[model samples]
Target: MLFDTHTHLDAPQFDEDRDETIARALEAGVSRMINIGFNRETIPTTMKLAETYDFIYAAVGWHPVDAITMEEGDLEWIASLCSHEKVVAIGEIGLDYHWDTSPKEVQHRVLRSQIGLARELHMPIVIHNRDAHEDIVKILKEEKAHEVGGVMHSFSGSWETAKLCLDMGFHISFGGPITFKNAKQPKEVLAKVPLDRLLIETDSPYLTPHPFRGKRNESAYVKLVAETAAEIRGMSFDELVQITTKNALERFGIS
Candidate 1:
């Protein structure tokens, strides 16, 4: 079994053949997937997809790029959504200074708010950190995010930073980027982190690994991510899949 811990299947990119893609994944033993929500519009789609597929689970929140339009009632709204059977976590939320879609202050304000929502709802969080790692670490610490420990999805930071998140009880998730031939930092971190502390994902529709690097990624390709992790840790691919899937289940509370 394999778990795709972070993916934006709600995006229009999957509209063409979402069912087929998901079917391929399940057929290939990629049975569970975390479909992340990234704004007001996607919350419903994410939930709907989760309801449609037995293996799909969801995390609802605003991505930093789209956090601007949320009003006061929105956090409450997300809280209510978290009560649903399909909702597993709170996020796709956090800082992203790489793109100036919104101001840093605005991102911080919204990120903190969502983090609070996750805490209030007693759910884990799925964080997205771009060039704003320093501030991300700061906000996570200030909010005491360890209370609802979750993943730093698509982590691109150093082992020093990785250790900081680990200290806070956060699991580090690596995606297709870790499979890149030249992705030295992520590979190094992959080798050093204990298996219990690591998770693997495809982050599909983006970050596709080598041999399929420029193509559209899906849950089915999560095998490449697992294979890469296996190579990095010098373990068998089957063993890597077994352990990471367990890691994802523990993190998301999936049975």
Candidate 2:
């Protein structure tokens, strides 16, 4: 079974046929999915989805783009939700230089705070890094995030960077970009990641895989990401599925 470890199923793009999208994922052999709650607005929706579906889980945090908007109460609320049966991790949290919606200093502060929260709670974190690799890695190390470990969602960095994250006890997760024809970095990173530390995600309602590019993404398309990852690693598709599914469960502490 495949596990889409990071997705935005709560995004409005899936509102039209969310049920059908989830059903398609199950039919496509995606046995589990983690809906990422990246902002206050999506946190309740994410939790609701997890509560409503046995196979869905949740990870809550403030996205770096919205870092400036996060208030103290929001952090407290996220911490409170961590004990929920369906909440699996603290994430979709990290630095994003691409959008710059939030100032770098604020993003850094928020990222560190959440990382500290995850450590205090003894929970794994799900990171989202974009165009701010060095600082992100530095902050994680400074915070000693290796204590709780986590997944680097939708990784798009050099093998050197991946090695650093792996050394810090972070799993490397790949998404739709790996299937893109011109995505050299992701392909290179895929070749270098150890199978045991590898994971797959769709980041759905976004990053749709090849052949389905430019269209709305959903969890069912994780199969294509797995297929491409398997090919890149020269492993059988079934083997890739089994290995990544195991990795996801291990990373998330799922049974």
Candidate 3:
């Protein structure tokens, strides 16, 4: 079995063939998926997808780039959704220095609030850190995120950063980037993560893996990510899939 622990199947990119793509993923052995809803618009669509598909799950939070748009009521909305049976995590949240759409201060405040909410609700979080490793680690520490340890989605940080997340009981997930030849750091970090804490994802409609790098990504392509991860850890493909699937299930508390 395979689990794409993160994805965005609700993205407009798949508007024409979303069901077909999901069917392909199942055929390729993806037994479970978590669709991320990072803002006001996507959250409802994501919830709809989860409600429609038994194998699909949801993660709702305000994205760092959209942090400026998060009003007080928005936080309450996310909190309300946390009670939904299909909502497994509070995330796709964190700092994103790469995008200047939202001020750094706003991103920090939003991330801190989400972390607090997750901790208060006793739910794991899914972090989306981009080009702000140091600040992300600092905020997560200050917020005491270890109380609700989560996944470092599409982790592209150095081994040192990975080590810190690992110390906080976070799972380091690799995506399409790891399948790239020049992705030396992610490859190295993947090798170092403990097997039990390892996870894999597609970040679908984005980070499409090698041989399909420039095209739109889908959950089926997570097999490519799984194969690359297996190669990095020097384990059989089936073994890696079993470990990561189990890790994903337990991490999300999926039955």
Candidate 4:
């Protein structure tokens, strides 16, 4: 079985045929997926999806891009939802310098606060790093996030960065980008990560894999990500799937 560790199934893109999309995922052997809740509107929808589908789980938090909109009650709301049986982690959270939609300072503050909340709740976090590696790693270290280590979702960093995150007890997760033809850095990083710390995701409704790059993505396509990862690591596809599925389950504390 494959575990798609990061996805945005609640996004409007799937409204037309969400049920069929989910059915395709199961038919494609993607037995589990973590649907991200990155803002106020999506959190409840994320919970509803998890509650409705036995195989779907949720990771709730605010995205750095929406940092300006986050309020104190939002943190409390996220914390309260952590008690739900289907809520698995505290993220899609981290810094995003590429967009700079939120001021760097505000992003930093929100990121730290959520990290603290995750620590308090004893839940793993799913991080989203984009062109802000140095500060993200620094904040994670300063915050001592190793206490409840999590996955660095859709990792696209150097092996050195991966080593640092691994040292800090974070699992390295790869998404559809790993399957792109021109994705040299992700391919190199894929080889360097230990199999035990490797994971796979689709980031669906986005980052579609090769041969389907411009189309809408879905959890079913996670198998393509796994196939590419396996080829890069020179392992059998089944072996890669098994290892990553195990890693995902353990990272999210899933049985």
Which 10-residue window of candidate 1 scores lowest in summed lDDT? Answer: 65-74
Q: Write the per-residue lDDT of candidate 3 for residues 1-255, one digit (tens) a residue.
A: 899999999999999999999999999999999999999999999999999999999999999999999997998999999999999999899999987899999999999999999999999999999999999999999999999999999999999999999999899999999999999999999999999999999999999999999999999999999999999999999999999999999999999
lDDT by residue for model 1 (1-255), tens = 989998878778899998898889988889799998888888899899899888899999989988678788988889998988889999889999888888888999999999888888889998999987789999999998999989999989999899989988899999999988889999999888878978988888999988899999888888889988998899999999999989999888888
Local accuracy by lDDT, each model: 0.89, 0.94, 0.96, 0.94
Question: Candidate 3 clash total?
Answer: 0
**Clash pairs of candidate 4?**
none
Better of 1 and 3 by lDDT: 3
lDDT of 2 by residue, 1-255 (tens): 999999888899888899999999999999999999989799999999999999999999989999999987888999999999888899989999999589999999999999999999999999999999999899999999999999999999899999999999999999999999999999999998998999999999899999999999999999999999999999999999999999988888889
Task: Tell me how many residue pairs clash in candidate 4.
Answer: 0
Residue pairs in collision within model 1: none
lDDT score, candidate 2: 0.94
Candidates ranked by lDDT, best first? 3, 2, 4, 1
| RMSD (CA, Å), each prediction | 0.9, 0.6, 0.5, 0.7
- Kindly list the per-residue Cα lDDT of model 4 for residues 42-152, writing each as its tens digit: 998999999999999999999999998999799999999999998999998999999968999999999999999999999999999999989989999999999999999
What number of backbone clashes does candidate 2 have, counting pairs of residues 3 or more apart or in separate chains? 0
